[model samples]
Target: MRKPTSEKNQSEIAYEVLRQKLLNREFAPGARIRYGPLGDEIGMSATPVREAIGRLASEGLIELVPQLGAVVKRPTLRDTTELYEMREAIEPYAAAKASQLISARQLKSLQSTIDTMKKLHDAMTAGKKQGQDIAVRFDKSDLKFHQTIMNAVNNQRMLTVIGDFHLLTEIIGAARHSYSIEVLEMTIADHTAIFEGLTSRDPEMTRKAMTVHIQNSRELTLSRLQDECPQ
Candidate 1:
């Protein structure tokens, strides 16, 4: 029997909300996701929320534990390494392609994200007390900036792959407590460079900027992992 269109829409809405929460690190890695409470908060029934969890589990973002139901997936050090490697290969190429193809509206959107990031950075630097809140917002904006560039390339496969990689990185980062004030500042600087390159519409310039940013991120992520799990 076919489900009602409204039911399907509710399921999708639940999925998107849950997915954003996971990607935004509102639910830390290994945190159990309870459908009932989530459904209540989102104004939906538990059934649709459960369906959403099932979808996330299939995407490797959520794990189905026997007794614990759905839990956010915890990424390993090797997972981090491989994810960065994949990003390094695909993102620079995507940025270069985007340089040639990105429309003015996309550029404007990218700039808007960067502007939001800068504001977050400023607030954090001013010693605002909500450090975690500020960090999560900054991460969300950072993801949006990269995603905007990916969208410009118009390659669905690469967009999907790279988007998941970014989300996984955020999960790992939240688990490790890896975002420091210095790191926030560095991200802003790197993104500013990438935005400038894109604005200039220079493929080589954009590609190089992206490569350098990814290398720096890889170095920081690996160093943090080593510090956390020294052998």
Candidate 2:
């Protein structure tokens, strides 16, 4: 029993390490994830590595093929469109629900993330730091802000679905978008509007703000994908 538990722990560790690699685009979209080499690289054995790969496949982060093994999932433009569609459907509702129930503590935490992002945006604009330098940090705060709202609902299933969408978008967008200053500014503005709505505790306002933000994100992401992968 202890040995099995140990293996499970190791597999979980492998899953997280590989998932972060995927999120970081260390494994590019469509890149083969060779099990043996990956295990060796992570200082783990094949069994645990295989288990971890299976978990990622279940999460739609990778695809398992018969002869080719596991490969990082490469979301197409259609996939991106569908993903944003789902987000648009769910997130605004989440924002509306969250506006009614979010605690002052959560609101404060969200505000802190926004403040950090604002500083990053200001720094980028003033040429104190490169946009890319702060891009990943800004993205982290962005994730936290949304996750905080979703978590407030106390619905595990909704959180899981929305979390998956967030992960997919981050992975795919990192593979494609440049995260330019203009993009960051647009994102900051959208987040500010959403934050204001949340602070106002106005459900309708929050919903509308969230809807607009998701719509802008869809357009920006789809445009970037089309530009880079023009056929």
Q: Candidate 1 has which clashing residue pairs, if any?
A: none
Q: Kindly report which residue stretches of model 1 are placed more than 4 angstroms away from their true locations once superposed.
A: 1-5, 227-231
The weakest ten consecutive residues by lDDT in model 2 span 130-139
With a 3 Å backbone cut-off (N, CA, C), the pairs that clash in candidate 2 are none
Per-residue lDDT tens digits of candidate 2, residues 101-219? 89999999998988998888788878888655576677788889999999888889999899889889887777653467788888888988988988899999999999999999999
Least accurate 10 contiguous residues by lDDT in model 1: 222-231
How high is each candidate's TM-score?
0.89, 0.90
- Across 1-231, the per-residue lDDT of candidate 1 in tens digits comes to 996559788999999998788766789878999989999999989999999889888877899999999999877677778889999998999999999999999999998988898788788778773678887888889898999999999999999999988887887778665357788888888998998999999999999999999999888888887755323
